[model samples]
Structure formats: structure tokens, C-alpha cells
Target chain A: MGKVAREVVEKAGINVDELVKKLVRAAGAEFTTYYYYTILRANAIGFDGEGIKEIIEDMRIEDRNHFEALVPRIYELGGELHRDIKDFCKDAACPDAYLPSNPRDVKALLQVLIEAERCAIRVYADICALTAGKDPRTYELSAAIMNEEIEHEAWCSEFLGEGPSGHFRRGAPGESPYVSRFLVVPKPGV
Target chain B: MERRWVTIADSSELAADGVKGFSVGDKRIVVVRYRGRYYAFDAACPHMAGPLDEGTIVEGRLECPWHHYLYDLESGENYYPKNVYPDDLKHTVAPLRKYPIRETEGKLWVALEDAKA
Candidate 1:
């Protein structure tokens, strides 16, 4: 069982065994999303330049660390890791909602990163809210994850240099003409 | 900065589920009517500059069609699909830039240029 989960169980006056199992499942979901984004970012680097490649690599390492961080908690909670990462990928919530059609396109990659960061921000925030005051240790860990996610989003946005409009324009070529057409309204007096 | 009040639309021009786009000099703005109130924001999305007027308003939040990023109309805060941050931090500083808005004579006016600080 993970040391932190054990502590939470011991301190929260709850059944240690049951809480550990719940945490294991929760961690499994988080690990799945982390793994999926890591793969997506890794693929994105090849289509982009060294700068993006470096960013992707750094993000991958961070995600892996998150997964590793959860393992101890899983074990301490007497839960097992979901062996197949693919299973988790199939139903990921945010970062996994959409994959870039071509990973080599820097713009596409940036768009994906922006979306992923946004998702991470909300998901981590929700997690922090869930654990707040209820489980101090978990709250601390989640809060940390939330901060990094925000940084990742800001980095991606700065790289894109354009907000939502720029993102859609860059990705427009990859999408069906119909989809692109639906994204804009005619400018007044244009 | 020059603040010229460009005529956006007649107050009654926007119906429920309706969004209109306008330009004041080089800036783009969107006027939306949802939940019986008129609201305005930067015409583009903060993430990738998605045209905000082209998106849909539901439950007081705007959902970008490009990636489904939802932003609260009132506070211009992204609601769903937020980024995750590390611990040891007190708060996340990421938020969309909000424009000042006023309703005069039933018409909504939004400052397209940065306000004087």
C-alpha cells in the first residue's frame, strides 16, 4: 500500500483497506491520462522543431513522474496498477479526448498541448477540491499537479502566439473544410 | 488609447442563442445574448484565438468549437478542461482577459481597447 494512502486512512479514521482500493482506482485513471498525453507529446516532437521536442520530452518526464508518484500510494492502498495503458487511453477524459492527425505539424501539436493543458487544469483543480481539507496529504499532491498544469498551458499558449483563433486557423488545414467553415462568422462590412 | 464606441448591434438584434461579431479598429469583439442578458468578450478564444462568436453559449459558459474549452461568460474564466499544476502552490494564475462591459439604454457596450489602469 502507498505510504500516503495509509496515512490518510489512519488519520481520517476510515477503513484503511477500502480507502486504499478507492485511491488505486483513482490513481489508475490519472496514470492513464498521463500516459496518453506523454505518447501524444512524444509523437508531436517529430513534426516540430527542437524547441517543441524539448518541451514534449520535459512534459513526458513529468507525466512519468506523476505515474511513479502514484505507485507507492497504490501499493500502500493494496491496489494494483492497470497493466494495459491502452485500456485507459480508450476512455481518457481531457488530454485523450482528441489526438492530432499529424504529429509533425507544430501548430497541430500546439493546439493539442493547449487543449491538454486546459483539461489538466480543470481535472487537477477538481481533484484538489475533492481532497481539500478532507485529506490534507492528497490535497497537497493535487495542488502541486494543478500548478504544473497551469504552467504547461501558459507555455503552450505562448508558443502558439495566438489565442483560440490562431489555434483553429493552424489546425484548419487538417480538418474538413466544413468544420473550418463552421468556426467563423463573416466579419461585419467585410 | 482612443476609445470610440462602435455601434455593435441593436439591443433587440441579438436573440437567445445569437452571437454577433464586431471590430473596433484592429480589435475584434463579440456580443452575445444568453439567459436574458447581453454579454461581450474578446472575439477570439484565449487558447488558440477561436472565434468566440461562432461558439455556443450554454449555462452561462462559452464552449469553443475548436477544442470544446468552456469559459464562463461573466468572469471570462475557463470552466472545464483546466490545466493541472504542481503542489506547494497556493493558486493557479491562468485566466482569460476580460473586457469591461456596460449596458446603456438597453444596448451593451464593451471597451475594445485596454482600459486606463
Candidate 2:
């Protein structure tokens, strides 16, 4: 726990403990979504259009990146992940992105992806809003994360044929254009 | 026996199939408006304490947002895995924890189990 770091936020009239709970939930959602997206991506092989797998994979790794980026901040605020993994996932801010009952249907799969991204957008947006003036570090980090989530939603929605994403592909999968600067240790796996 | 009737949010606030969760003393619970009627249940899923309020409504059953486990609203029965996995004997899934709720004058009240006894 960053004793002085948390004190400043508390003195700013922000409920640091409540904010920490929200942060942990948001991080849990990202990690659990990463898990669910793996299953969704595997089924994307021949189901949807050409870039289906790529879109899912990109969001999957970036979601993990979001988790990684949020951890240091969580500890900084004096919050820690639950000792049990089950508790952590159960308390995630966003719902788990479970594969649809019928995974073969491409449309259902796309809907799952779209909804998950949309939920992520809400999560980060809430964090950004909460910390906007009181905590510069958390606010900036959440805003950066939300920027990526917005694009992810657009990509998934576009894939679902809802509309054009207005985005070409990222330089590579999970490039995390807005968030990579926060990841001191690069490469989600490395 | 004593019962604690706690007033929940106004009826107009919750839409159809909508869920709202709150703390009644030390216990967390969710008040759901389903099919134009109000029903209350323990906010946490029996399996993993998944926020049932975050769950999706499906055919009178609520799907736990964490694992997609389904629970019947009124009966508080495990719906999904029970429907899929037959009595092969490893029935770890439990029924939804339920609370009794009543409505009067545009407001809803829930009877919580862990009230001061």
C-alpha cells in the first residue's frame, strides 16, 4: 500500500477504499474476459468472416493487458486481489463473457464479443469519471483503458455487421495503442 | 418468529426483468421485477457469490453472470446444469437463496432472513 499515495486521495474527498473495490472488480473482469475470449476465439476459426479470429485474439490479449496495467494501481490504493481465484472472478465488475449455448452460430458469438466490450467500456468509463479530478494517476489510466475499450467495441460491432468500425487493424494483435505505455513489462506473456 | 421488512426501491424505478441489489443490514440481496411482479433473492449466487443482480434474465430464470449457471426465480432451483447434467452424482450446484418480498403503495419491501433475532 502506498501510504502517502492513498492519503492524498482520501484527503481529496474520494473514498479510497470504495474506489479500490471498483478497481479490483474492473481488473477481475478484464482477466476473466480474457479467459472467456479464448474459448470464443477458438470457435471463430471458420464461423464468422475473415478477421473474426484476429479481432477476438486482439481483444483477448488487450483485456489481459488491461488487467496487468490495473494491478499496480490496485496495490497502490491498498487493495489486493482475493486469496481465492473464485472470489476474484465472482466479484468482477462485468459479467463473464461466456460462450453462447450454441457456439456454432456466428451471430451469437459476435453478440457475446460486442456485449463484453460494451461492458468493459462502461467499467473503465465509470473509473475514469470517479477519479477524474481527485486522482490524476487513476483517472488518466482509466481514461487510457477506456479509449482502447471503445475501439474494441467498434471492431466487434463492425464485425457483427452493425456498422463500419472506422478503424483499420492495429499494428499487431493486442497492441493496446492507448494502454501499452503503462505496461512497464512488455508482452503480456513475456 | 420475527421478520424484518425493509423497503426497497420504488416499483417505478425497476423495469421489466430488471434487478436491483442492496444491503439489508449485514446481508446483501437483490429485488427483481419479473413478469410485472416483484421477487427478492439473495444477491450472491450460492455457487460462487456471483452478483445475481448482474445476471441476465432468461425465461423466468436468472443466469449467473460469473459462470452462466441458471436459477429459477420463484422456486429458487438450479436450472441449467440440472437440466443438462443428470444424476451422475457430483451435484455441487445449489438452489438460489430466496427472500420473501411484498409490495404496497408503489414501494416494495423484502423480508430478510438474517434480521436481528
Candidate 3:
């Protein structure tokens, strides 16, 4: 708990406490999405000959990265993730990305993926709006997370032939191009 | 404990469409005017607590602005999922509890309990 770090945000007229609650909710959404995406990834295999599999894996891992990046900031703002995992998950800011009852339907899977990304985009957009021009650190972090979420949406939307994502697949899986800077602790394979 | 009537919003703050949010204590309440009458309800939407204070009264159903979840304006009974899915899908949502509200002299007041739900 850095006293001055929290002090500065409050002094800027931001409701430091409410901001912390939003961060915790955002983190919970990321953590649960990581868990759910793993199941979706398994279902993705051999679907359209595995092109979707690789993308699902990237999104799954990046969602985990988002969870890792959000925690330190929550603590910096004097907030903590709920002590009970169930409590944390129940309060997640987005609906659970449940595998469709009909997982074999590729469009059903894509719809789930796209909607989850859309919800994440809205969640971070609100955070960014709240912190913009006030809390620089939180603002940067949320803006970065929002970038990745938007790309995730584009990728899923393009896969569904909604349109071109205007982007290509990751150079390496789950590179998290926008959010990587905030991920200070490197994972083993990175 | 008896609840006291608290002034929530000026009648003029509402738009012609009659959708607006006002803060009363720590709670965010949405005040809507439907059919030449006003109504108030807590704004937390199902699942994400979103669609907060940004909903529309469409044909007497309050529609969640983001996901389009619908509820009856007066009774607060959810009218979605149950309408869209199969008869056996058995989708149910927690009813949105309505706050007891009154309009007088161009002002809206709600009787919120000391410890509200």
C-alpha cells in the first residue's frame, strides 16, 4: 500500500475507493475468462481444421495476462481481490463465458467469444473513462487492456466473417502486444 | 425502522423521453416517466450490474440499454429470456424491486429504508 500513490488519485477528485472496486471486478472477469476460454479452446480443436484453435489459445493466455496485470494496481489503490474465490467470481463484471450447449456449432462458439470480448471492452472503457485525466497509472493500464480486448473482438468477428479484423494473427501466440508492457513478471516460456 | 421521504431529482432534470439517473445517498436510482406518469427503480442490471440508469421505456417495458434485457415498468417482472428461449428453457431473472416514489410540485421523492436492499 503506497500511501502517496493512493493519495494522489484521491486528491485528483477521483473516488479512489469506487475505482478500486471497479478494478477488482475487472480483474475477476479476466481471471474467470481465462478459465472458461480453456474449455472453449479444447472445443475449438479440429474445428475448421485448427486455425481457430491457435487463436483461442492466444486469447485464453492473454486473458490470464490481463488478470496478472490488474492485481498490483488494485493493491496500489488500497483494494484487494475478494478473499473467497467464489465470491470474487460471482461478482465478475461480465457474464460467464459458458461453452454453448451446442459446442459443435462453430458459430455458437464464435458468438460466445465475441460477446465476451465485447463485454470486456465495455468494462475497461468505463474504467478508462473514469480514470482518464486523473489517475495516470490506472488510465494507462485500463487503456492498454481495452486495446487488447478490442483486437480480440475484431479477431472473433472476422473469424465469423463479420469483416476484416484489419490485423493479423500474433507473431507468437498470446503476445498481448498492447498489454505486455504492464506485465512486469515474465512467465516461464517468455 | 421507518423510512423517510428523500428528494431525488428535479422534475425538469428528466428529458422528454423521461429517462435519467440521480444519486440518493450512495445508491444510483433511475427515474422514468411512462404514460404520463413517473416511476422509479434501482438501476443494477442482471449479471453485470450494468444497463444502469441508461435504459429506455419501450411499450411499457424498461429495456436495458446494453443487452436489451426487458422488464415490466410497474411490476419489475423480467420479460426477456423467458420470451426468447424455448418454453422449457425456464429462464428466470431476479425481479427489479421498485422504490416507492411520489411526485409533488415538480419534484420527485422516494421513501428509501434506512437500510435499503
Clashing pairs in 2: none
The candidate that wins on DockQ is: 3
Interface RMSD of each: 11.2, 7.4, 5.2
TM-score of 2: 0.67
Candidate 1 segments exceeding 4 Å error: A2-48, A83-86, A91-99, A162-190, B1-117
Error of model 1, residue A150, in angstroms = 1.4
The CAPRI class of candidate 2 is incorrect
Give the alpha carbon lDDT tens digit for every residue of A9-44 in model 1: 567665555444434434544565556556665566
| Candidate maximizing TM-score | 3
Write the residue-wise lDDT of candidate 2 on A6-52 in tens digits. 99999988999879988988889899999989998887756353458
Error of 1 at A51 (Å): 2.7
RMSD of candidate 3 to true structure, Å = 6.0
Q: What is the lDDT of residue A120 in candidate 2?
A: 77
Greater-DockQ candidate between 1 and 3: 3
Decoy 3 TM-score against native: 0.75
Find the 10 residues in a row with the least total lDDT in model 1 chain A.
A172-181
User: Which lDDT tens digits does candidate 3 get at residues A1-190?
Assistant: 8799999999999999888878888898899989999988888756472768888888999999999999999998889999999989977766567777766767777877887887788778878988999999999999999999999999999999989999978988889998899997886776
Docking class of 1: incorrect
